[model samples]
Target: MITRIATLAAAFVLFALPAAAQSLAPYKDDLFAYPATLSEADGGAYRVVDYREMRDVNERDEVPERRVRKQYISLGVRSQQQEMKLGTQRFVAVGTQQGASMIVLYLHGQGGSRSQGVNDFTFGGNFNRVKNLVAKAGGLYLSPDFTDFGDGGAAQIGALIEHFSAQSPGAPVIVACGSMGGMLCWKLASDPLVAERLGGLLLLGSLWDESFLKSPAYKRKVPVFFGQGSHDTVFPVEKQEAFYRKVRGKSGNYPARFVRFESGTHGTPIRMTDWREVLNWMLKS
Candidate 1:
């Protein structure tokens, strides 16, 4: 009887071994094995394909071209007395200097000028990196100064957009603002008319809360790109992350991206050579 019982126990162990092995197999494969490749026969040869891998490669290779055609236009709008009290108001249009598909309205940060400083609020003398980048991306750049430190400047921009629309109907407009200008950009983005008139919104160093994002107007329209510095002293990464999380959670279908730079201040320097990357993303969006 003892011999028979021992033999039965050994048999049970053998049966259980394969089941245990099978249970662990998937975990091992997930960690170590290359994802299974799908193949299809084309003619006489089998072609192995992976759609995700292809997309990654395509995105990686995407870079904007170096050659850019630029044209400058002087845009002047009448300012109210209140606006004049804030600061000088002027609008400059920069484009391929020829036929362009999209128009980009650029707003500088606090203490920023259209002619001076890089995109990040850093003072790089005589460096208009943002304008050059926009030009390379095949989009027209329009830089406007707000009457009072970029506050209530959206009205001026709206007027300009209306005037431009009268001349050229059905042109796509994109709003790009950094820091304080971002405030105005958000305001314009929430407007129904502006939403219909504009194509997308790009905000750098934006200092707004989730309440602004919760607006139904912004949710229905406007694809936004939010870029922030991870080590930003003025705008901490935690706050940005929290705001992004809220936006993502609220709007499941919104086309919004939050990119965190490894190292930079309020405004990161926009290198002309790096315009390719910026242009590629802008054009693709």
Candidate 2:
């Protein structure tokens, strides 16, 4: 049965990839036309852009006039004299403006920036819709660019949580990640500090290998929502199901839920919408 499911999953992946590519072609140009300048509240120079505006530009073929209500934050440490230089990390925070009810920390997939799987700086048209949805749901969205293309471990995510918590106190935090970020979420949820502050976790298209989940220190107590494409090529259905089974066995009363989208491919539109469902679940939780 597992072999049959795997073969069918492979076929679905093959069929879904090219169809997704064609659907994404129309909004490709809005990715890089973001606004060039932003003045921070602390009198610092920061570049800001509305990812939704970029998407509108892609769909309409022109940059739309809109107020710059939110700013994209770039966080990193630069080398000083006789010190090694770590590369800068880029992240976008939507709902940083007033009236945000909660704070959400987002980690993107492999080779994806802190935009949380959306490339508004390149291809536009509702690319960053999840962030906007969180904001509309009265929450602040915080995403961080991890070290080495999101290959950074739990420490990076922890640092981002601390920084955002310091910036906005008393706001409940929810952590969300996709693909490699899902692995990071798993690692972070195990930490006591993270567990103390985190209200929920959302994992999208996660690659949670069996060995990783079986580790002794990887117990997660918070509610977790996991969504994946039924046809993900990178992480097949059998592997995902095996990982889910392991997690279910290891954690007691973990409140974990899984949804598999039919005919979905890795990093495709269906995958992106699955993320939106994750955000919705987080908000309700």
Candidate 3:
């Protein structure tokens, strides 16, 4: 609990500042990279494959190569003066929640509010910017208050999944969780009902406990794109690599990949990297 508080405090404090002082675009190449080869189970996990293994793999898939213009429509959340309000609901949509074919449910880190997820783009090169780009690309997006997903989080997430499924029927759902919010994601992915409708996972500086990892969800084979930093003090990079390798070593073809940021701290990678392509790949990986 102490650690959670500390991390949350750091996140908000850091986000309150502008990134122009130390933006990631300059260090883009030094901090970002994708796996050269997608792992396969051809006799040995070391086997190479020219094509990425997955149902969404499309070598021909095209993604935006530039920073997109940010767009959004405030849902239940409203901000004016120095005050923020929930209005009548516990969440807010960073983009239109209309006929989007895909929904990106961004779960913010602990002690953070739902409003911060989309409103914090002022810091630049942040999740809100990524959300804006995805939204502009015709995706439904939301970030719920941390309180909604804590004691009663699972039910809330399940309801959103159900709502999106009913709204768009076969549209895929992406749970883009960060930090403590990821705890809910692990449980959600483990659920048989939720797992079936999942498009992919965008794990940004999140952690999966040993137990959930050993559960049936571990074998779900959902395409997961991780953005983790080498200098993360909360969760070490070695553990992330081990989990990736283990998933790859699993019996089925798992489309798993990670962007190892050489010098980024825990939240820096999440805040700095160009996620348009990564998010694009997960939707169609």
Cα-based TM-score, every candidate = 0.58, 0.57, 0.66
The residue-by-residue lDDT of candidate 1 on 1-285, one tens digit each, is 001111111111111111000000111122112123353322211122222323222222232222111211111110100111112345555543233455666677788765432222122211244444444343456666666534367777777666554444555676777777777777776666776766666667667655456554466645666666555687786787676556655534555556554444566422111223333344454
Q: Which ten residues in a row have the lowest lDDT in candidate 1?
A: 16-25
**Against the unseen true structure, what C-alpha lDDT does each candidate score?**
0.47, 0.48, 0.55
Could you tell me the TM-score of candidate 1? 0.58
Q: Largest TM-score belongs to which candidate?
A: 3
Checking candidate 2 for backbone clashes, the offending pairs are 31-120, 31-121, 31-122, 31-123, 32-121, 55-125
Q: Write the per-residue lDDT of candidate 2 for residues 1-285, one digit (tens) a residue.
A: 001111111111111111000111122123323223222211221112122323333343433322211222111100000111122444555543233356677677777765433343222233344444444444556666777423365776676666656555655577777676777776766666766667667666677745445432345445566556667788775677566656655533444566554445564322233344344444444
Model 1: per-residue Cα lDDT at residue 38: 52
Error of 3 at 207 (Å): 1.2
User: Model 1, clash count?
Assistant: 2
- Give the Å error, residue 134, model 2: 1.9
Candidate 3 residues lying further than 4 Å off, grouped into runs, are 1-89, 120-123, 148-151, 211-220, 250-252
Off by over 4 Å in 2: 1-88, 97-100, 115-127, 149-153, 209-220, 249-253, 269-277
Please, what are the lDDT tens digits per residue for candidate 3 over residues 58-145?
Answer: 2211222123223312222221101212333366554334455566787877777776566643323355455545444555567666
Candidates, ranked, TM-score: 3, 1, 2
